[model samples]
Target: MTALDPFTDALDCPLYVVTATAAGERAGCLVGFASQCSIRPARFIVWLSKANRTYRVAARADRLAVHLLGHDQDHLARLFGGATGDMTDKFTRTAWHPGPGGVPVLDEAPVWVVGRVQSRFDGGDHCGFLLAPEAAQHPGGDGVRLMFLKDGPDISPGHPAD
Candidate 1:
């Protein structure tokens, strides 16, 4: 395997806290690998590391909610990004409610969307979940400036698969 440095290629893409609830259990995590993949039909995709607890929950989820973090929401980013759901309850520390398909929608987020899982693909260490937007809510704001690489704690992936 070729070792490529992600640090050099790390773009300041929007950061999101993606949550999925299945079988009465909820899981969430900070996500960086996501984007709008289609314009005509308005489709988006979020990639999750297989080792993440959120991925395990999302695998059985019919829908997933994506919440964009504002510039000052570093704590939200820490709960989902710096901490691992395997050992901690990330949801208990955040404000959220059940949304479409019972997925957890972060209340503090300025913008959020719930989408039905359209397809899933294996991307080696991560899995790509293509979503079809079913519902969206944009609570008015300055369109919260997205969190980036330089904004939060630099924690190493707690799991081996990450």
Candidate 2:
């Protein structure tokens, strides 16, 4: 662990699911490394693991969708996080519809945003996708509890984190 672990370990931010479509193929995965990086003019970034199938698809995709999971939506998180897309068809197991640029938008998410890929930053074992909001769906949260990192440290990553 890096020196940042002391601070990072105590953190339990909300989890998210990111989906993308390219060349008629779709992919998505559980993401813990994403955040809004700008306020004025609005910008958000999603870091996709190089080992994830979604990352490969997103590399060729022009747009992507980011869905926020409610605290009680462990099943949704597990489905995205527990299995590799190489072996499982995640969309078939969940409710979703095509959104702008044909990105898959999760139906059960309380909030979701579709963004045009502004740029790509390839670094380390993951590439950061800089997104500019294109469209969004806000069903309006009524006590929508969000999912966090407390799902247990042993939670198997859909793909090995390496």
Q: How many steric overlaps are in each model, in order?
A: 0, 5
Q: How accurate locally, in lDDT, is each candidate?
A: 0.86, 0.90
State the lDDT at 98 in candidate 2: 98
> How would you encode candidate 1's per-residue C-alpha lDDT over 6-85 as one tens digit per residue?
76465667888899999988999888889999998899999999989999999999999998888888888878887788
Error of 1 at 32 (Å): 0.8
For candidate 1, the per-residue lDDT at 57 reads: 94
Question: Candidate 1, TM-score vs. the true structure?
Answer: 0.89
* Residue 38, model 1: Cα distance from true site in angstroms: 0.5
lDDT of 2 by residue, 34-152 (tens): 89999987999999999999999999999999998987787888889998999999999999999999999999999889999999998799999999999987767577767777652
lDDT of candidate model 1 versus the reference = 0.86
- Compare the candidates by TM-score and give the number of the best one: 2
